[model samples]
Target: MTTNLTQHFLLDPEVVFLNHGSFGACPRPVFEDYQRWQLKLERQPVEFLDSRRGLAANLRVARTALAAELGTDADSLAQVTNATTGLNIALQSLPLKPGDEILTTNHEYSALEKTLLFIARRTGAKIVTVEIALPLNSAEAFHDAVLAGFTDRTRLLFLSHITSPTALLFPIERLVAEARQRGIWSVIDGAHTPGHIPLDLDALGADFYSGNCHKWLMSPKGSAFLHVRPEWQAMIDPLVISHGWTADNKEPGVRGPFGASAFVDEVEMQGTRDPSPWLAVPSALAFRRDHDWWQVAAECSRLAQETAARVRDLFGLPALSAPSLSAPQMVAMPIPPCDPIAVHDALLRDYGIEIPVFEWQGHHIARLSCQGYNTREQMDLLVKALGELLGLEQPRRKLGQA
Candidate 1:
């Protein structure tokens, strides 16, 4: 709030936008860079799309920049449109037979839950969902709960790096390591991890990790990456065949026609779609670096946690987990039992505050996302609106007004 970073974002001034976790609002500089890439592509459509020209090289430059930040080499990653796409590419490529198990948690994003269900229906792989207890006090508790579900038939381990429904940061490093030791393929859905947390994919040692650059990174929408370990890259297949396909693409050390590894080429080059969002990733990284985003993120985390606590206390609900276990910028504050749809609509319609209010696991939750552009005043407005709309009795002075 003190830094006054709101001016850099492209959000509408009238509405209080607290839903950065849903689909991120791109910064002005990053948006401009995205437009520039789009314009360049429009000007020379064939040249820009053609790998023989400079498409592959330009994408490599972007990937290398992102890889350096993610603590991995360029060849190990493939730029995808979004995390779901990247996840699907990884999920579909795995060879799951009938009765094989995919171990996950109940806190996964809904789309991915459906994706797993789809994969399960096709391959007859049983999706084993572990229910993590609320008010998580320790990382070891979470680790134990997830690992307990693993069995000899467990062929894959899939879970969110930062859960979408509950917004709790799962202790995945230990689980990933355990899964690897058990010969279980680890596929992580890191949709909210790229800029929200410090990420070192190699050090984490997951066999496959996919994350969105658009969510916490504040890049243009449709920018994300799927990282595969070099040994597993040969088994991973692209979602679409397109021009990048070659006969020996599944074979290791095979280079695509574009000169990069077959994994990068087949996965990245999915035909004539706009690559502007992926290309603009470097600008997003530079914006964060120049703006001292880590300090900003720390401040935002404070604001988000404080706001969540205030809301929870007002509603007389317990905290979801320890502060350290929650995401730095996003928190799912528990609300009193109510119709989530009505509350979500009323907040937007009457209060002009934009935030996600939904029901998860039979509990109503208002998931608040704190970005650099958000203010304490906006949070106050949200709290005030919730109290009034939920019919909570306020003190004599009322809330958010003198």
Candidate 2:
């Protein structure tokens, strides 16, 4: 509740950052840790660059810590720059044939949607976007709608664990199980799941999953990961071809002198890049633990519920997801009829509130994310601003109104 604790972030103090779900704000301590790694790299470029051992070792440490947090083995997981890159790798690596179908929800992120479209066009595969109703009434309804999208010809099911535009957490556990039963591959875009919800990759049971640490985990930007089941590993080809493609007659699994297998040699050695963000993941984890993020999340959930109630009361709109179905930490509320862009811009320019507003299936949503730093006063300001701007109470003076 105190600005003292919140001031450690480099976020603009004048703005109320309600959009942590988009890209997370890194803490000062974590930022310092990231810089330390950068400094270390600069101090010994020859020792670090000439030897793959140092980079691999650091990666192994990061992988172990991340795997423990995600409840998966380190061997099946590797760090990537972000979830988008991971999704691209997954889509491009999959062996799709003509007439195959990739079923997804209409609520998917636009970037990943474009990637799927590109794959469909190149491989003659079909991308079927099933409409999942907004102002969702119950968990059963959501599950039924998603399951209805499956078909005999469906080769893959691509879905967002937490949808970007909608900001609703999909019931992926049941879907993953059903997809497995149908012998269909499940590739989940978990970009928003890692820090917001509990994730056990082994227990979640997906063929491929990718998440961004930069968003919720409070890691520096460009920190993300990709997890692939061992069976599908053979089919994956790195997007880049470098030392990983063909090393000079080296034994398998061994980090060959300089260059290696396409998986490790190419992707791992993208060449003279900043590994600071990835290396600072452990520090981010420590920061979360030190701050008691679990309790912080619980508090945020309470605040989110309160904020949602207030917004719904002001607008007379329905809730997007059932209280039990959605993560308590984040809420996507239905906004009364308005231009999403206009409302979004008004909130920022007039009220100094930062949030995401978008139209989903004929309903406009003002998705509000509650992080530890946010206070009830900020939510109240948002409500007041929204009421005045939308003429919910009375016709307030417009921007240019006399």
Which candidate number maximizes TM-score? 1
| Per-residue C-alpha lDDT of model 1 across residues 1-402, encoded as one tens digit per residue | 676599999898988999999999999999999999999999999999998899999999999999999999898989998999999999999999999999999899999999999999999999999999998979989999998999999999998999999999988999999999999999999999999999999999999999999999999999999999999988887878988876684555778878888888889877899999999999999999999999999999999999998998888889999999999999999987776777777788778888888989897899999999999999899998888877556422332333
How far in Å is the alpha carbon of 306 misplaced in model 1?
A: 0.8
Model 2 RMSD in Å is 2.7
CA shift of 11, model 1, Å: 0.6
Worst 10 residues of 1 by lDDT: 393-402
lDDT of 2 by residue, 52-114 (tens): 548767876887899999998776776789999988888899989999999998989999989
The TM-score that candidate 2 achieves is: 0.92
**Backbone clashes in each candidate structure, one number apiece?**
0, 6
Q: Please report the candidate that would top lDDT against the real structure.
A: 1
Query: Which ranges in model 2 have alpha carbons more than 4 Å from their true place?
Result: 1-4, 246-266, 393-402
TM-score of 1: 0.96
